[model samples]
Target: MSSVLAKVDWKSQGFRYFPLKLHYQRLFATRVQKISLDGGFTCPNVDGTVAIGGCTFCDNRAFSPSRRVRRDAIQAQIERGITGLRRRYKLEKFIAYFQPATNTYGPLDKLKTLWDTALEDPRIVGLVVGTRPDCVPDEVLDLLDEYAQKTYVSLELGIQTIHDASLHWMNRGHDHAVSMEAMQRVTDRGFEVSLHVMLGLPGETSEMMLQTADQVAKWNPAGVKLHNLYAVERTPLADQVRAGEVRLMELAEYIQILADFIERLPEQIVIERISGDAPPKNLVAPEWCLHKGSIIRSLTDELVRRDSYQGKNCRMQGLPREPS
Candidate 1:
């Protein structure tokens, strides 16, 4: 560890890792929340532009709350999300997250209309767009750049794993090279980028997962969201789990793996999400995933036991350090 890393106190921060909430507070000087919005977008993989049948593990409704309910206009969805979020959190500012599906997989004009409508609301402080790595073309990035000049903008790319075989097994439609190219373009435009990484994918070993973390550390993205692969209803993964073709990670094993993975990442990256879960009705396996609180608690305990914090092992692993 460097001198700075040694002098810091992790426990005082209430988390073993740098969390997204803290990152937002430092940037906006206020509490911020993300409101999920269904932009009525679909993926090229699903529409047969690139391939058929979306990712094996994907069922938009299971991952995005906005997709489960009745479809509404973009503005209406924002209003409804705000109303619901207000009841849960005492925050005023929010980011319009075009979540659900490939948010940037449409015509430039249509994309502009939806995004502009959300920003029209003063309460929406930023925009977080989720899409596949191959979906964001240069023109789409240019449009996002226009927004970045006006307000906060984050382009979330689903780089599930860097392994080509795992991607093929999941039918991700694109290779790891595509993901790398997308990250380069987005970061080159000075956009804040968040990478989504999935763990516990079938056939990935602990060494392979750590390798993905190492690559992510090298990318030095602004944020990262980590989650174990869990099966949900109406998805191919569920059927695989039923047929014993796939096995989900147990809670304890995942905690250890996740902690190890985080330690390999640089401390500057905001840990956007520690785990993912779905509605009870949609969730199919690893019943423990539904209990998010327990998962978090266990992760914290494991980190404490190891006397570790985020990036504690970075230097030992010869990972690149963030520029001072």
Candidate 2:
């Protein structure tokens, strides 16, 4: 490794155990929490701008904490989210995260108005917008770029899977090419970018999941959010699971896949999430998915058992550096 990369204080820097959570602190010199704000945005696929019924596995309400929908005002949601998060975490600064739907799907003026409203609170130190690849346009990117100059900003694109079959299966409005193009545009403009991927998607094997990792590494994103596929009630995926057309990966199987996937990724890539949990009331299968704490412990134990760490076998090899 170059002396620059070798000098990273992995242990003290928190990369030895978990790198993603601490990445923001290291950059901003304090704990910066992300407050998920529902901006009442809709996806092209859901609105018939692309397709009709939305993604197969999607039910936006399932992922939302307060079950926030389009009717809720952005400011009220942020205030409520901040109050709860502050009481629990005692955090002072936060990033306004526009999560759930296609955050950048509207016109530049409307998008800016929402972003400005969310950022109006002085406590908010940054902004992170999550949206589909096809939803981002030059104007949206330009708006995000303007924010980049002022505060911490990251554009999280939900790329899900690189395989065409999986993309088609999910009824994602765009193809892999569009995702690549979106990523390139974000990176080329020197913006911090993060991508989301799901493991154990129907028909994807361990090898295929790792292949997605390989492709992601080549793109060199600043962060990644990894999730395990789980069936939720009232979604098309749940129907498929009930019909025995889809099989969710068990807890142990998902742990192994996650550990292996992390090893294959470049060490510098911040793991924004290891796995996702669906509310018990909304979940239909893979009962173990609700055990977040146990899963983390098991994952830590597995890593220790193998005496391995993130980037143990990256596609682009770098000389191992001692953890500080």
Candidate 3:
């Protein structure tokens, strides 16, 4: 009998199967590592550029598994993170992931010193900047545009959802159109963009998530991450979850939601991550999805079990997905 996932043809489907880009095999081809660096940058929400308080659900401690969050210097943080990373695996090079409070929410003059210091390190192979859509400006994008010419520069935008109501409920400063414009602007700059979206947000449904994914696919980012919302302890969303004001998605429900999300992509956008990797230590609700590897594996099995793959809809329309 013929099977759908039999060969796991990422190219045949017009989009790389979520499994290919979502898996570790491609992330660390030869056992590379992610060195988390804290640029000590503040957020607009806290700095008075946007809302007084940050997102209701935000607790960056929940993301960025990198251990160098508190390190004072960027070079020290990178070196320490790299040395610590060796305890886990043996990799000569690493992707220095700038994953802290708004990485670009600062003056450009300071940005130069911070970035130049990190690049001076010899072990760093690539750079990944994680920031909010509202944080990055045109000049910063131009800086990244120039950097991409020499090194692999990955810009990750934390766009939790496209639904305005959900954005309001989550306290994300930017709206749907802002996110789209930000993505289009950055994508047009030639620097690779890795978008971050979440599922199971307040007042969001399967349809809303599909809509979010549809819009993200249209942006055609190099990577799209769909994660289920995790309400960390002490966050506003956590209080809501405790008081029954908010809801969480079960692992199975989340898996189904993720599968549906992959179906909506334009077939060319790479599905970098399919779920939020909220560490269990800070996580409060839906503890099951905290284990990223297990969630990914389970999601892969479900996709295969359903006899489906990424871009199932695109291939039907005779549209070829662009290479991400």
Candidate 4:
């Protein structure tokens, strides 16, 4: 562990790492939930501009509830999401998250209209757009800047792994260099960037996964969402799992590796998510992922066992501390 952990009251907070909820409280002074919205966008990979099939492990419908339900007007979706989220959580302020597909892979006019419609609701305090690294051109970035100037805007880039061979195995279309270029470009624009990384790819070792984390720490993204590479029904990865060609990480193994991964990240990076799961009907393997609560609890326990917190082993020096 590093000296940084000495100043954090992680034990009292019930999480050894910096969680997104805490980050939100610091920024908004209240709990802010994310309302998932489908902007009716398709990926370059799915549309044949980049490649034929989407990422082998992806079935957007399985990952996003917005995609599973009927598509509605952007404003209507905001209303519906707000109503549902309000029913469950006490949060009033929400961030409009364009989550299902490549949100930036659209005409600028259409993108602006959708984003504008989402912000029309006063309760919506921020915007999150998820997309591939290759999809955001300079014009799209400029458009995002237009929004960032008005309100909080986070661009979630799907840099699943830093290993090019793993990307090739997943048919990710673009290589690691493309991700680095995208990161540099987004950072240049001064937009808050959150990276999405998958830990349990088909051939990656634990060391390889930690290497990805170490590299990401150097980039120093505003946030990171980590999840295991689980298989979903109707995807190529599912077929491989059924054929015994691929194996998924067990819960205990994933927790340990995730703890190690977080230790290598800068403490300032918000841990947006520690695990991900598909809807039970769409999930094909790794039944353990369905229990998100258990995954989080076990991971927290593992971190407690080590008496460590985020950045405990971080090599990056002189990074800004989390805002006071």
Candidate 5:
């Protein structure tokens, strides 16, 4: 290498390879807000259709703020949320994200009422329903499709991994087949789909993570959330971490794996989020990855340093055919 090139320090350069939030803001032409609504949705695992206690690594308490889970009418929750947000940010349009649990696991009208309540607020642009793949039904899909005609609607399906063994170990109620079927069904109805996939699951190698990204990109989803697995306090995985029964990847190692994952993903996929959101207070393991945007920043720096970019592996990848 040239002496001049060798002296160039990327650490000092400070540039991000893939900045996504800017793209979202540009599309909105303002601060596009996300108000997480509990909506009192319950998981299938806890509902006894699958298992109990939800995922072995899940603690909804860690994810929800106090205001989000208030036991009140859905409209009241939105009003209170908006009333609180009135001070800091003037967000004219927001996404009502049903974040706590499986949003589609209810009677058609019951679910419809919960969702329609969100639309009553003029500030609300649309709905962002978070649910397991298996929880979605035709009746729900029809509602989402019709809602999309009136406003923006994006379904965030938690298709964590394509590996069955990993799902089993994580106590995820549904399998990969369920995820595929859900995505196919959601897409066929012309509603936007954003998949939630995590990296570094138990027994899942980096190659397997890349395979999941390949499948997701091919599936023609509008958005994607790439999260890292962390052992949260009070979860079964935390016990394994304390006992040294489960291995946790270091931040740097995870960043390298995630860089590869990003390169394999399609550029068109709106990356909603890059890292897991386990606050230091609630996180029990993999403590090194808790420095907020450290993982995402490191991943971007690595990508730029390696001169890598997303969709670099698109042509060679044999992904399932979805609508163009």
Candidate 6:
């Protein structure tokens, strides 16, 4: 198996798996981890500006750390996160990740203040601001563009799926067109863009999920996070799961779907994550998701078995030719 792993130049493969760490190292010349922060942010959808209840499948608390409450001051949380991460990894640097809720859905000055505080940390070399596509306005983009020139600034948008129907079913507040416009503007400005795409929403079939990847390939994101739909407690999705209205994909089924999704993606895109894992205590279904590391290893093994890598099926799907 080690020989099989060696047979492929995983680094050179057009569609590589889990390439973010190496990509960061090439730029920063050091190891970096994301220090997740809760910015005490809220979504317009949940606030009645758009619609209520947020996304059907979303329960932000599912993945948020228990110690980092939303009420904590931004710098206080960062201090704690730095201490925790440094102790665990002996880390030298980190990117402050604004991951909780819709991180940009706030007053412009407040937004600037939160980000400025996080950026003020000496150990934080960059900012990874995660937000909904619809939430990022021209003002937010302007701020992010300025930061991009000074340090490693990345805008992580949750594009979930390219299908409007799926967007609607998920109650994502904005349509696919909104995501397209936001992506175009962000990438055009030369800021590194990373997008979030979910594979197995309730109504999607394997073919439909792969189609989403094809659409993402056209955008040519700098990084992509592939997530599986897992039922979490206290979300409408959980109710649907309980009512037998929706079915989550089995673990093996998700792995195959993920490989197909990755193959359709262009090689230049750094895969930030292959599978999504909710905290075991918060996860309501698909117990297999708890074993994230094992799932990633299984994915690499499957790729080896098939003698395939990220973009082996790209041209076959009518995607742009990989750069020589």
Best candidate per lDDT, number? 4
**TM-score, per-candidate, Cα-based:** 0.90, 0.89, 0.86, 0.91, 0.85, 0.89
lDDT of 4 by residue, 1-324 (tens): 011233334436777888888777766779999999988777778767788777998874433312322235787888999899989988889999999888888788888888888888899989999999999899999989878777888899999999999999999999999999988788745457899999999889999999999999998888999999899888989999999999899998999899999999988788999878588998898999999899889988888899988889999845764332
3 or 6, which is superior by TM-score? 6
For 140-226, candidate 3 gives per-residue lDDT tens digits of 998887776666678999888889998887777778888877876787565678788888886787888888877776666767777
What is the alpha-carbon RMSD of candidate 5 to the true structure? 7.8
lDDT of each: 0.83, 0.79, 0.72, 0.84, 0.73, 0.78
Candidate 3 residue pairs in clash (backbone atoms < 3 Å): 227-276
Give the runs in model 6 whose Cα sits over 4 Å from its true position. 1-18, 60-72, 316-324
Q: Higher-TM-score candidate among 4 and 6?
A: 4
The true-versus-predicted C-alpha distance at residue 261 of model 3, in Å, is 0.5
Candidate 5 TM-score, true structure as reference = 0.85
Give the per-residue Cα lDDT of candidate 2 at 144. Answer: 87
Clashing pairs for predicted structure model 5, backbone only: none
The full ranking of all candidates by TM-score, starting with the best, is 4, 1, 2, 6, 3, 5
TM-score of 2: 0.89
223 Cα displacement, candidate 5 (Å)? 1.0
* lDDT tens per residue, model 1, 1-324: 011223223348878988777777766778989999878777887777787778998884433312323234887888989999899989899999999889988778878888888999999989999999999899999989888878888899999899999999999999999988888888756467899999999899999999999899888887899999999999999999999999999988899889999999888777899888588998999888888888888988999899998888774444443311
List residue ranges in candidate 3 displaced over 4 A.
1-16, 19-29, 60-72, 315-324
Given candidate 3, what's the lDDT at residue 316? Answer: 33
Highest TM-score model number: 4
lDDT tens digits by residue: candidate 6, 1-324: 011111224456443464787667666778999989887777777766787778997784434212333333888888899899888898889888988788877778877787788888898888888889988888889988887777777788999998899999998889988998887777666367789999788778889898888888888777899878888888899999989898888888888988888878766677888777587887888788888888888888777777877877764444432211
How many clashes does each candidate structure show, in the order listed? 0, 0, 1, 0, 0, 2
Error of 5 at 136 (Å): 1.1
The alpha-carbon lDDT assigned to residue 70 of candidate 3 equals 34
**Model 1 root mean square deviation, Cα atoms:** 4.6
Give a tens-digit lDDT track for model 5, residues 13-40: 3533334454345445567667888776
